[model samples]
Target: MSKRDYYEVLGVDKGASERDIKKAYKRLAMKYHPDRTQGDKDLEEKFKEIQEAYEILTNDQKRAAYDQYGHAGVDPNRGGAGFSGGADFGDIFGDVFGDIFGGGRGGRQRARQGADLRYNLELTLEEAVRGKNVEIRVPTLVGCDECDGSGSKKGSTPTTCPTCHGNGQVQMRQGFFAVQQTCPTCSGRGKIIADPCRSCHGQGRKEKTKTLSVKVPAGVDTGDRIRLSGEGEAGENGAPAGDLYVQVHVREHPIFVRDGNNLYCEVPLSFTKAALGGEIEVPTLDGKVKLKIPQETQTGKMFRLRGKGVKSVRSGTVGDLMCKVVIETPVNLTSRQKELLEELDTSMGKGEEAAKYRPKEKGFFDGVKKFFDDLTS
Candidate 1:
């Protein structure tokens, strides 16, 4: 039987590009592949025909000759540059399925970068707001001094792997399917150290504690990260070291709770000072400042001290300090204090007149009386 035209076999036009040819070949090959066709001889022959057509059209020289002189220019029986032992099945497989399986054509491996490291740094609120220089000790891998991070002995060097010939990978074939995997002998490094370094033992790195000083910027809050470049574990085989991230966790303050840029605190006020009004000292980060309390000040009244809070690190804007006053009742009274209190209560009068002295208390009873009156009626 006469053979079909290569472009006709692959369902593409004569002027089709190599990319379009490959695409058509892949689609037809998958459809009529021997495995998919279940050992049908006619379909298997079609698969072989598709492979032969793809091989001839994809090769630049053979394709050029066939384009000018047809199949006579590429037929081996007719003294033409024919299929050289069929198509490179490995190349076709890689082009079609390499991305799905994460395997591709083998080459020398590049140096691997070191892993990043994180250090949780605890800071006081004062230090976080004001900023300070802190020294930390981190245990990690450092490049070997003896071998200069090469993993070889002091005077020697690494040699190319014998198994993969410095390709760092080996090809495994099962019938027509080909897969590339890391070379077992070299462990995918492409190079082998015959004389291992005494210090690092062929690993190219050594574990040691490193002391580094970090400058904490002012106004940095909790959850902030400070990056120190080239301070993480040393890279494999002298590659670039990774970065060290200093994670900030500010400790809770005894007097103040910070919220974003603002600081909140509860100030205890004596009932006498709250009722009569007075100038009281309030605690701030810098120092103590006097805040005047107005007459008849109630509990939970918030007083704002402008610019007494933290300055924002990103925006450079200052915040306020919110002081919520909590009225403290007089306790541990002596007989004389009790008599003075009794006299004061007696002077405030009783019933409707006493409502002026204790307005909230009278309002509560008034609401209770209306509730019962509605229920009865």
Candidate 2:
């Protein structure tokens, strides 16, 4: 069969981007792989055609040569003195996975790093403010003991893959181009296990739970992550383990709400206590302390207790706790108590000047009357 133009064979323009070429090749490779098609000769021929088109289009020098003199000019094995070497499998690997997979363009791959881990830590408000040492149980992937992560049988070691010659890559020649890519045979690990280890099932890793003690610093808030090095999943082939990150989350407090470093709380005072202000016990993290209220202290009045809040981890500065008072309306009142309150109300209702102590209450009533008048009008 006469060779089709390489671009025409791939169904792409000659000026197609490298990405487009790779995408086209990947699609064709997956669709027409010999293993996928079994004994189908037509699919195998189509696969070969795609491989040839990709081989030429992905290369610069071979592509330049082929553009000038077609396939005859860039044939590496044609005994042509002017033709340079074509693409190798390694070249394509560097373009595809890159540093993200840490599969670099180095002559050989370095030791692979272990996996990272996440550990969620719960803390109470007191513990978060004062700091605590906690023991956490974590599930991790550890190296197998039988073969020490070699993925081999008890008495044997893993063998280098013969298909790709232990380079973990294979070279496929379609026409004028030769590209280096990862060896599909070994999945780029450069070795294969004939008799897989029964414990880890050839993956070279095992599941294990380990306990670790972590010290939470004082004033650490939710969303703060502390990194513990070499505490994550163990790597294959004795590679270094990755890091473990402990993410802090503070538990909800019944008494206090946190705003940054400051703590806020609503403290309740009875009507008599609010009317005739007196010292009352208020709750604090440490213990109860007597707080003084001026005579005739009103509801919603805030009292700041300095140094009763957080000592921030970053700033190391102490914050304050703000306590707002809410005057309790004496509900479920006894008959005598209700009668006495009605008598007091009659006394206060005698003159507006005598009811001067209830300015906000009077203003609210005035606003209510105005609202009624507006509604009626």
Candidate 3:
């Protein structure tokens, strides 16, 4: 029987790009793999045919000859120079399944870096505004001193694995295909410890507490991180240690609330201070400053204290502190004080001067009267 077209066997068009050809082949190969088919001879044969098609179509020279003069031009059985042996099959299989199986040229794996760690550092609002260097205690894995991280007893070293002969990989034959996998005996270490260390028990690491100092930059808010390199858990064997991340969490201040670079706070003003005007002391991050209340100042008035807020960590721009004045009513009253207030209230009765003195109150009452009148009408 004549051989089928390579593109037709892989279910791709003749003009299909190399990417499309590989994708079609991957789908068919995965579908017809003997491992999944479970010894079905027909499916295994189909798989072989698909592999043959992919091997030819992916090769530049063989694909060119096949495209111009068809299969006979490059067929090895017909004495033409094509894939006469399975020289490139390993490369193809690795390219397809290497990620899934960790397949590669066999050798001992590198020592993996230790896991990164996070430490939540709570900071006061003042501390976040001003930078501080803090020391922290961390419990993590460190190299064992007993065997010098070699995982063997003193005066003895690890021996090469007998099963894989230190290659760290063994071959699994799937029909004509040989898949390289990590050796079961050595667990890919390529070495066996005859006598394990008493302290860390051949793991080469032990649990210990380490003290590290972290420098936190100024104006750092919540969620900001300071990285301390090589301060995390020790690596396996002799690999480099991971990093430590100090995550900042700013505690809520009772006096002020921060918004980006700005600060906001409500200031309680006495009724006398709001009406007669006075110099009131307001608390700031730096120090107390006197804010002059204007004569006849009303409640809910906002005062901006420029350059009195936090400086941005990134931009270094200063912000203003916003103070909203809230007029406070006196709780305890004397009979004489109540009498004086009554006299003052009578003096400012419903008149033109009363409208000027209490414009907001008069306007609110006028609005309420108009609303009720509209409802009745």
**What's the distance in Å from true for residue 322, model 3?**
1.7
TM-score of each: 0.72, 0.67, 0.70
lDDT of each candidate versus the true structure: 0.86, 0.79, 0.82
* Per-residue error (Å), model 3, residue 216: 1.7
lDDT of 3: 0.82
Q: Model 2 segments beyond 4 Å from truth?
A: 1-112, 153-157, 194-198, 365-377
Query: How well is each residue in 261-318 modelled by candidate 1, as lDDT tens digits?
Result: 9999999999899999989999999999999999999999999999999999889999
Better of 1 and 3 by TM-score: 1
User: What TM-score number comes out for model 3?
Assistant: 0.70
List, residue by residue over 1-377, the lDDT tens digit for candidate 3. 78888889999998887768878988998999999999999899899999988988876556876786677557655433333212133433443465345455446644567766779999999999988899899999888899888889878899999998987777777777777777799787888999999888999899999888888888988756788888888887777887777888999999999987889999999998899998999999999999999988888999999999998888999889999999999879999999999899889887667998898888998899999999999
Worst 10 residues of 1 by lDDT: 81-90
Writing each residue's lDDT as its tens digit, candidate 2 over 68-163 gives 667665555552212423234343445455533434573334446677788999999999999999999999998999878888889999888888
| Model 3 Cα shift for residue 362 (angstroms) | 2.1
Per-residue lDDT value at 346 in model 3: 87
Q: Once model 2 is optimally superposed onto the true structure by TM-score, how far is the C-alpha of residue 345 displaced, in angstroms? A: 2.0
Q: How close is candidate 1 to the true structure, as a TM-score?
A: 0.72
Q: Is candidate 1 or candidate 2 better by lDDT?
A: 1
